[model samples]
Target chain A: MPQITYIEASGQSTTVNVPEGWSLMQGATANGVEGILGECGGSCACATCHCYVDEPWLAKLSAPTEGELEMLENTASERKANSRLACQIKATAALDGMVVHLPESQE
Target chain B: MPMFRFDPYSPLVDADPFPAYKTLRDEHPCFWSEEAGMWILSRYHDIVAAGNDWQTYSSARGNLMTELPGRAGATLGTTDPPRHDRLRGLIQQAFMKRNIESMGDNIRDIARQAAAELKGRKQIEFISDFSSKFTVRVLFAVLGLPMGDEQTVRDKAVLMVQSDPKTRAKGPEHIAAYNWMQDYAAKVIAERRANPTGDMISQFSLAEIDGDKLDEREVLLTTTTLIMAGIESLGGFMSMFALNMVDFTDARRQCVANPALLADAMEESLRYNTSAQRFRRSLQRDVELHGQTMKAGDFVCLAYGAGNRDERQFADPDKYDITRKPRGHLGFGGGVHACLGMAIARLAVRVAFDEFHQVMPEYLRVQEKLDWMPSSTFRSPLKLELSIK
Candidate 1:
């Protein structure tokens, strides 16, 4: 299991062990993380799982697909260089101790 | 105890199918319905798994149990992935939550206007007066369709979902409505192509992905399917939400007192009684579940309504608790083919309820016996007489 830290917009931080093959969105949602709604159940269709990857961990994660990019454009929060949909980032041992910042709103 | 039997088309089941759904989930999780000639999966986990595995339970053949002619491989709901993905990606831009949220004020205005129309009336038919009219108007406004023919379009949309129990297939009127909608959609697509606008139809006409655009037939089918679905399914869900409020007065009161609770209440209403009851998926490969093996080419019905009520998934699944935030509920279906208009549906319904509650905070169902739409795929009240005063 890879431990991921989710820092909310309110500055509250929660860490959870995300099982292998589970997306960051699934881990956050399943563990009751407040900011990530994961409204579409890990599907890239809904942009409700918007999150900002911490600077260091941004380089390790896979690049966003065209679909993810399209959905990112609709995120309620501001999109940044490190912004990503948590559903698109799969949890793996290589990405242990990754930190993702939750957006202010996921609407 | 009598042997459990389930029929999606039975008027009795149509009236109240929860008990039958419970029975299916418990004794026969993967029961085959002889009447409808389809295998039914009732458990929540089973439905979610089936919906996710599009390769096994395919939607390419046809998604509707009472599928209309020439609709199997035509539109978003009927196509498989790669193609389905492309179609969805192209069409999704217009339905994103951000875009829909901008329409909140307009939706609220429409809802307030509709509520105001019944200001002097003590008794009102909810479906006709409020739900259907509200949804149709919202959809037409969003799509840039003309309003004068709303009643005709609504009638055709309603008829499009109905199946003849005796014949076990689409009725004559259903076919007629399908043809009418097809022609209407073609004309609309042509007009939109000729004169592009900011509406959804125009967006579909102009939407492109890497130089690949929706062909005329694809646009036509998508338009036709959306009009019917946008009208009936969305309207039916609104009616169901109203029915839930009427039945669950306590929950309704809580929502009325605190507008914030309305969003959760809407979700609870969906989980408790979704308008979309059953949709079919063709088995692309042999799959075994609970001692029954569904062979390839066989049609399997994914009972979303039944799955939502599965006790294994939710505690006291039958109870309509406003606080229960059922995030992954099958209210919008699941997987890649989840309801595209979910954002719009949520926005419209929430705004509509908020506006309606402002005017009429409370209402009562005038009749105990309710008449539901005769459709296998969708479930909703055809008429709900309510006393506003």
Candidate 2:
């Protein structure tokens, strides 16, 4: 299990052991973590499940697809270069302590 | 020049399009249709790219093949972001998964009552008796419209997209239906304004994006667009799923035995027989694809039906496998302009099948001939009269 840390915009941080292969959005949503709305049920269609990866852990993740990047631009919250759709991020052993910052709004 | 002569509205394709779709995908990935005057994209990758690349393929002109042009900056579906994003985001929460999930009981009850009505009837048209009832009742609940108005709304909504050859030729009649939708939506908006309530209509009336609220016209168009986009397709999809059960008994039995696989069954049905076969998009800029130059303003039909059945994407794409993984399917489309009411649709479908199977677990297909309604965009059985076992 990969231990993932979800930090809310409000500075609240919660750590959960996410099973490998589960999306970050699924993990955060499964544990009732606030600020991640997988409105499309983990489909990359909706950018509601966007999360900002902590800079330190960014190196371990792959680049977002052109579609995902376009979706990031339309997210309710302002997009940073570190921004990513949580559904696109799969939990792996290499990212055990990966930290993700949830946006304040997922509209 | 089109690699192969194909008319989407032709009787053969209208009756069953998979054969045509397969041909289009294999022969001409980006075929130009002289009859329709649009470039047809059939491959999964092409459809996905076209949908995502808003800069290259704009939706501002509208997505309907029969729609009158010059609709830029109009409804959510017909516009590009940041306008599309703002419009969608404003009401997105209203149709969110949590909210739609909350309506599960309402949907289930509607499905149950509709299903129960079939108990004594030896023969029943699934579309009229059951699917329409479930779809319309749920729409009423979601839109905050009066329940008594379900039939009127359903009738008009159906008329708006009534695209059979006869109906297609009746331009004035289609326009009349379109006008009725706008007028009805305007009335609903006025009523919501006079008396605010906790419904999607009221929410749209009160919603603000950047402190700017939707005007009467905008609200009316939005409401009408939502109804136009939602009603028929949802009902059509339900009918398609029911027909699938009759066509695939073993798959149906598997679903009946393990209700959990209902979701997967629905996905397989969606992929196998996508209701919204194709949607149109106008090229934003001149683009070359497969050695053809498609100029800006040229309409392009993103063939979701073909893409869904693309052999490269799904293993044995023609085979309808309920247990197959359902992810990455473009049944509801993709990218920013994806179906807004997807959550609501999914919930309604799951609940509809769950309640329906409980009441009528088994059914038989009486006839081999199904009257598939002719439409350039949508595919539906005109009437699936079933005799319950």
Top candidate, metric DockQ: 1
User: TM-score winner among the candidates?
Assistant: 1
Off by over 4 Å in 2: A1-83, A86-107, B1-3, B68-72, B164-170
Q: How high a TM-score does candidate 2 get?
A: 0.81
- Candidate 1 — which residues are off by over 4 angstroms? A1-35, A41-43, A51-63, A73-83, A89-107
Tell me the docking grade of candidate 2: incorrect
lDDT string, candidate 1, B223-304, tens digits:
9989998999899998899888888899889889998888899988888999998999999889989999999999999999
The local lDDT score (0 to 100) that residue B43 gets in candidate 2 is 90
Q: Where's the lowest-lDDT run of ten residues in candidate 2 chain B?
A: B162-171
How good is the docking of model 2, as DockQ?
A: 0.09
DockQ of each: 0.35, 0.09
Interface RMSD of each: 2.7, 7.8
